[model samples]
Target: MGEQKVKTLAGDELKAIKEAGSGKKKSRKTTSGQIYISSSYNNTIITITDDKGNVLTWGSSGMVGFRGSKKSTPFAAQRTMEEMLKAMKGIGITEVDIFIKGIGTGRESAVRALNGSGIKVRMIQDRTPIPHGGVRKKKPRRV
Candidate 1:
């Protein structure tokens, strides 16, 4: 019977790993940004982006461990927004323009959570698309 020897990293390998991590720069601080919340029937997704539309971070009810119907609930949306707020605070975001889309149970609650968290909402826009008159209806079929 033979015993297998465990391999360990040498000093150079360890130093390389440490230096690689340390070389990365910290994220830039942003004070004004936009929050895009899409609350569909199945899930609520919240994304924080810079003024120019560069995404900073995002959170979703499903990503937070909510499943099935629960992901569309207000509570799950609130939790998702809470997670987003925590991430926003790290980058010094204090003001936001909120763009909301979709029809879901979480719509109002997500907005409320963001407001209650002390982040100044400059504007709230509903970006949901409303369909205009389109193609003509099909002819009635005989039963």
Candidate 2:
């Protein structure tokens, strides 16, 4: 009979997996990276990526133990950033270009947290979607 497939991961693949304390163990060294902050009405998610946008690690308010309405608060976002900051430093990221989205309360706080963490912010760009007139309304219901 043919050999069954093995579930084992190679050393490199194993290292790619997120660690409990530091998020990820970067295989290559990098000093500058991109920070993507997705602040929705319900929660804030921060993702760290390489210069080419390859995701290195991410953290969310929910993962930081925020619940219900607390997840949407700026404080939760700050906490989320604290978690991500540890991973960022472990991966040797010193500078970042931040891209923010959504109108949630965590939007500005997430950015400020990164800025105040001693990491140089190279740029802050708002990538929020602004509908250009948006889609047409549906026709009125027939009588």
Give the clashing residue pairs of candidate 2, or none: none
- Give residue 126's error in model 1 in angstroms: 0.4
Positional deviation of residue 62's Cα in model 1 after best superposition, in angstroms: 1.0
Against the true structure, what is each candidate's TM-score?
A: 0.79, 0.76
lDDT of 1 at 119: 87
Highest-lDDT candidate: 1
lDDT of 1 by residue, 12-49 (tens): 99999898889676697989999999999999999999
For candidate 2, write residues 7-88 as lDDT tens digits. 9888877776745457565476689999999999999999999999889899999999988999999999999998999999
Question: What global local distance difference test value does model 1 have?
Answer: 0.94
> Lowest lDDT 10-mer window, candidate 1?
19-28
Per-residue lDDT, model 2, residue 85, is 95
